[model samples]
Target: MKISATILAAATLGSLFAAPALAQETLNFGIISTESSQNLKQEWVPFLAEMEKQTGFKIKAFFAPDYAGIIEGMRFNKVQVAWFGNKSAMEAVDRAEGEIFVQSVDAEGNPGYWSHLLVHKDSTLNSVQDVLKNAAELTFSNGDPNSTSGFLVPGYYVFAQNGVDDPKKIFKRVINANHETNAMAVANKQVDVSTNNSENLRLVQARQPEKFANIKVIWTSPLIPADPIVWRKDMPKDAKDKIKTFFLTYGVAAPGKSQDQVKKEVETLAGLQWAPFKPSSNDQLLPIRQLELFKNRNKIAGDANMSETDKKAKLAEIDAKLADLTKRMAALK
Candidate 1:
């Protein structure tokens, strides 16, 4: 009787402890909504299905309205893994103890994309200078303020050059939107111009060709690094290893497939493919931080209370930091 009772007690405790591990084994995968919810899911389903098969863990998809949602998710531990742009990945690293482990490479083998300031093709605004020359007369749409290409690129280049912190105040009217909304607004002539990225433009070409045909890119910013895959620093070593191994080996066939075979297999998974990650670090974020630094320097330059000597000192400091950032950025190339 005593032996039977002890066995029952041990079994109950074992099951109680096992429940948490089983429940937590599922990864909460967070993604920024670069496409419609349905389309986004469609793109990821195959990739993640393979990821799960390889990693032996279930990944439950979590979608966010904007980048900030994923940042907050990581900060609060609601998400264990995420796909983040360079800027947002920086934010996650700073605020959420996140680490960048991998990045995507385009089919062209460039691990970068561009930010574009787009205007209606039929509009007379043919150049960025033309838009800046009449900033107050035009309606504009800047995508989410958290977005790097959608906000930071245009903010630092277009509005800062025009000496306005409140871009909305300078323009006749402004709308804060996501990439899709911005593309639609520009295509429909609902706004004179808007911010967009190369990735979203591809989606537009595929899903809304007529809209894509209507928009003309007025300016393209310097190549922004590709988005990164991030995971919490505190996650278990085994889980992290599994995540890295899966991504690094993901698209490339194991050394023997013909070019045709690889292409056909790759087409089945529509997500960007870069087999074997480059092993990224926070240095990947220097340019993004530099852009933020640009915004700060621009603001300081406009300060009326700072004397000439003080302004000179501050600008010098900013320039020195930028020099360091520039060197680090150039080294990565």
Candidate 2:
């Protein structure tokens, strides 16, 4: 559902501006590059400028080379704000005491996206079942192991299902690369199939339509939660409040000449004119949580030398836990 920020800000301008200046300087926003730095700068520079202008503080965007780079930045507390995928976000929160503040809504206002398994148009692969049977013979391209749609989610949903008994023993090869490289590898026929996010695939195709002309989606996973914007524990409290306010109410109509400017800012950040970011919580991240449980179970099963009874008991425990996880995930709004 879409949220409107203008309605919330009608209370008073004094409250929004009550923060002290000393606290504002401590906010350093970090953005992970799912796309290239150049592309990210193009899309986010204006948005950052608008946020700084509105908040009366200089908000710097700390760009990272890759997923690992961002993780390191957050771990050291060099970054105060971070945009993270579900898997990487969990890592950031666990290791850096980062808390999620905001999540992006799609053009349709949905809070999540999906993982897609794609193949070349002329390939004989027709379904997920077909791909699994020939898994050993085909070269697979997965994004970083920490990636949500790229690796963790896809692996947990697909490979982990077979108990991860070293599934690659059935596969010809596996390659871990950035999402863009994974797309190119499949397009160039270097890999027969690869896992990617539908949203990112759309962005890639928008940039180079010809490269993906021969590729088609073969499988799509259940809706995965969108990435989250997180804040470090060491950040100044007033600055944190200001950041949250700006994110929550930036796009809604404001009185006087600022109304048009607010609308423009919203469009730049969210691509939907005058739309507000709704309140989100960890509860919406149930899919990623489920994936984590599946991974843990697979690790237990992969133990090289387990007694027959212990193996059976572990298997039974996994089934029972998974059933509970499924029920909880389904119940999440």
For model 1, what is the error of residue 295's alpha carbon versus the real structure, in angstroms, after optimal superposition?
1.9
Candidate 2: clashing pairs of residues: 136-170, 136-171, 136-172
**Runs off by more than 4 Å, candidate 2:** 1-26, 165-167, 255-259, 270-275, 302-304, 307-333
Show model 1 residue runs off by greater than 4 Å.
1-24, 255-265, 268-277, 305-320, 326-333
TM-scores, in order shown? Answer: 0.84, 0.82
Candidate 2, residues 1-333, lDDT tens digits: the string is 111112112133234335554424434567766666776777777877877876676667787666776776766655667778888888887787677878876655666788888888888998878888888789988777678988887787777875554446667998777777777787888999988887777777777898879787888888887777787655556767778888887676755538678767666865321136666665556667767877877877777688878988988987887898789877863
Residue 178 C-alpha lDDT in model 1: 83
Candidate 1, residues 13-41: lDDT per residue as tens digits?
Answer: 23422434643356778887654667777
RMSD for each of the candidates: 7.8, 7.2
The clash count for each model shown is 1, 3
**Clashing residue pairs for model 1:** 248-276
Task: Identify the candidate with maximal lDDT.
Answer: 1
